[model samples]
Target chain A: MEKIPSSEITPESVYLSRRRFVGSLGALAASALLPSGLRAADRFEELRKELTPLKSITSYNNFYEFSTQKEAVAGLSQGFRTSPWTVKVSGHVRNPATLDIDDLRKKFPQEERIYRLRCVEGWSMVIPWMGFPLASLLKIVEPTEKAKFVRFETLLDTKQMPGQGASWYSWPYVEGLRLDEAMNDLAILATGLYGNPLPPQNGAPIRLVVPWKYGFKSIKSIVKIELVGSMPISLWMRAAPNEYGFYANVNPAVDHPRWSQSSERRIGEFFRRKTLPFNGYSEQVAHLYAGMDLRRNY
Target chain B: MVWLKRAGLPILAHAGALTPLALLIWNFFHDQLTANPIQYITFRTGKTALVLLVLALACTPLNVLFGLKQAVALRKPFGLYAFLYAALHFVTFVGLDYQFDPELLKEAIFKKRYALVGFAAFLALLPLAVTSTRGWMRRLGKNWKRLHRLVYLAALLAVVHFVWLVKSDVREPLAYGAGVIVLLALRLKSVRRASAKLREKLVGKQGECRQVAVHEDLR
Candidate 1:
């Protein structure tokens, strides 16, 4: 638990770091309204920019530990051990990297970009994600052509995450995406949000942020990354394939086995809003699904 | 007769059964439904309903095995409340999640095996609730007993419904199954005792029962 300096919290540091992030794309905010603690980015901002046009900037999340309540995640994740963490990158890449947490954060510059994260269960949260592009990390791994998809696995140890001990969700969190989807600029390997290290419940150290797909696809607290040629086995999909599809694209037209997908409740908003195609990042990821009927694929 | 008074105690038990429903509604109105209100409400209501249904089904064995005659009268209200929550669960799934999409609803029921089983359990409980009133029970007469047997079936369906819906874990359904088996065992024991008592009463004048003669020899 090393203490971050008070001066390191300023917006200029965050903005300067963000500006130098992967050739800049989105707008820089006034920075005055944002709290000092909410200004810096980690190493995944470049990838997050392409997933902009976020619906709301404060609500989407996957923390279920202290409470399933979205507001409780930040408070609950304080108990996490973020240091001495390592991400094991395995499978079809030429160089298998097992990088230390701090080393991973220092590898790339940071940026502050807002992106909408729509959950598979029909809820949305817009987050001012602070990190560099995931594609940059993928570049480092040097994925071979044989790799067709990238799968992510969360730490299943209930000792670390109390929520895993409960029967609430099929615990050890797992999610994945196709190779092209993984390499898509909209995809990010996030480590921080609002200028601070990602709260534990929100996937501290590092996690996948696949903006166009459902939130679950963005596996949190990732300890393993595998590149495979076949469709990766997803926990939820294997549990109930009809309810949670393998593709799991954010499509309004597709209805879940037991629920409708036409509309979604933005986490902070009072009312529900119509769900957008690719969660409103159609311009970026929609082409990836071209020639394929979303409803059928859904 | 003391037996008559004891039999009437079931009426008292019926009043007691309403306490849980009252507390549940009170908790909901008071905003004690947890942080994620939707999940909290859904889980609480569904769980309470399942508990009540199990209790209602337990009445027969409880009355015969434990002589909990008063518990028998609680069946109707408990059964109806189970239906109420089951209906509420369905509505929340449809209203809050689906927003009244008929095509989606139909497809969800037909396409997904678990959803279909859950929906069927809901449908089975509906008839028991509709005929729960004294007037309907009287009008239906003995047919009411036959129709109410659907509860046992409903209990089985409910357990299956939960089992199918669960992705991997079997713990919850296993608990429910154990409860159902214990209750059914009590019912079986009661039924066997009643038949034995009838045989003894009918043969009392003869005093020549074969088992009795064997017991006398052993003594």
Candidate 2:
């Protein structure tokens, strides 16, 4: 109610289908023929990289909020209601408020960015997401000097999400990034992917995308964003601290206690590929962890 | 018709045993093996192996609780299929998942407790699978039965492997563990006698239910 970003129109037209993503490849090629379109196509250099087939991308998801079984999530989440959403930004902010989901895109124009998403389970996917920078949103809320970290929370509606009743995991999934890490340009709060508004299984309406970290770091169906002074204990960290660390940067050298992190199978490929440090975003974000020991932090 | 009755259960067992593998192949071909094919294959094979192992363990209990002495005959085939699936699970991990990279394999076998226990379970089944033939049974005599008891160890290890790998939401694995524990509990002499007493009354005239559990060519 405090930091309202003006009024909102109904959410933009969302083409929530696999065809748009599958068709984008051809569209990119044809658009190259036009001078103006070529610049736009070239802007998304990462798009040319092998996009995980839209079918696999949608069907194979790790939204445990819907189901633990990856394939079942798509089917189980088919009836999830995502419209008429609000995100409350509070804690350690000068102007704490709840903003309409549509106003986010209206305030910060959405951009198309293709990123590689790696899961802690040692599987990977390359996805094209439509969203704006978290830094822009963070600036709007205006964090105070006491704020050292940003904690994100997913919605906790048991009637809507069946997996929420999975008592072993403390519900209302939570994840956090350091103040500096939250401000990084690579972090984006995504609303949609592959020219379509996100399907329920892929976290419809809104989600976070921190490309460098494990997929769990990108909490989905977010309802709350709170800035705090101390490092927040994530669900995984609280569940198995020995395995899942707060700074879960994709470090191949540090193996998960349960499985090998040294290599990962790209979803579509037959063979496993060597995992990159910081998921190949080391060049851009490595300096943030410059002096810290990653192995211990991991 | 008499031959059909004699052969019916074996035929049914064969169909039931091979179906999971066939479905796995069908799914693999149809692009229904989910996003992570290797993982899908791994879980399918591992689950099939564990389930079949439990089924094989169930055969004796079936005979013990009922007068169907023929149930003991299924123990061998079910166990052999369990071994087959366990081997496939191992190959999927070592070959497809890791591409037989020795360094990674070494690291995993040492670092991951689940891998180590799973490998031990496979090793436990190896001797039972090998000595399953009549030739080896004739060769070892009483020793053969002693060696074959390692299957109980294999079943226990496989369940532990499952429990460890699944970090949380352990209801599935724990259920399997409880099953193995109950089956193993059925092996106790006192429990077996009590069950046999109950079975004798239930089975009435078919009093061939004397021996609660006997290793009949159990490989």
The true-structure Cα RMSD of candidate 1 reads 9.8
Residue B177 of model 2, lDDT score: 98
Model 2 deviation from native, Cα RMSD in Å? 9.4
lDDT of candidate 1 over B1-219, digit per residue (tens): 887687566655555556666776898798554334565456556666778789888765554434444665666667887888788788876676556667656767776666777777888898888989889989998888888888877888878877765545668787997898776664564554564465467656442353244233212
**Residue-by-residue lDDT tens digits, candidate 1, A1-298:** 9988987776887778766662233224523454322332322343354342332222324565344545455566677887778888889999999988788889887766667778876667667676777778878998998988888888776775666666746656667788888877767888887777776767887888877788877887788888888887777776677678778888888776544477776653434678888887775677788898777676
Q: lDDT, candidate 2, residue B141?
A: 90
Q: Weakest 10 consecutive residues, lDDT, candidate 2 chain A?
A: A9-18
Error at A160, model 1, angstroms:
2.3
Best by DockQ: 2
Name the best candidate (by lDDT): 2
Off by over 4 Å in 1: A1-78, A156-158, A162-174, A228-231, A241-245, A268-272, A292-298, B1-36, B94-120, B181-219
Q: Model 2: clashing residue pairs?
A: none
Q: For each of the candidates, what fraction of the native contacts does it recover? A: 0.13, 0.90
Cα lDDT for residue B104, model 2? 89
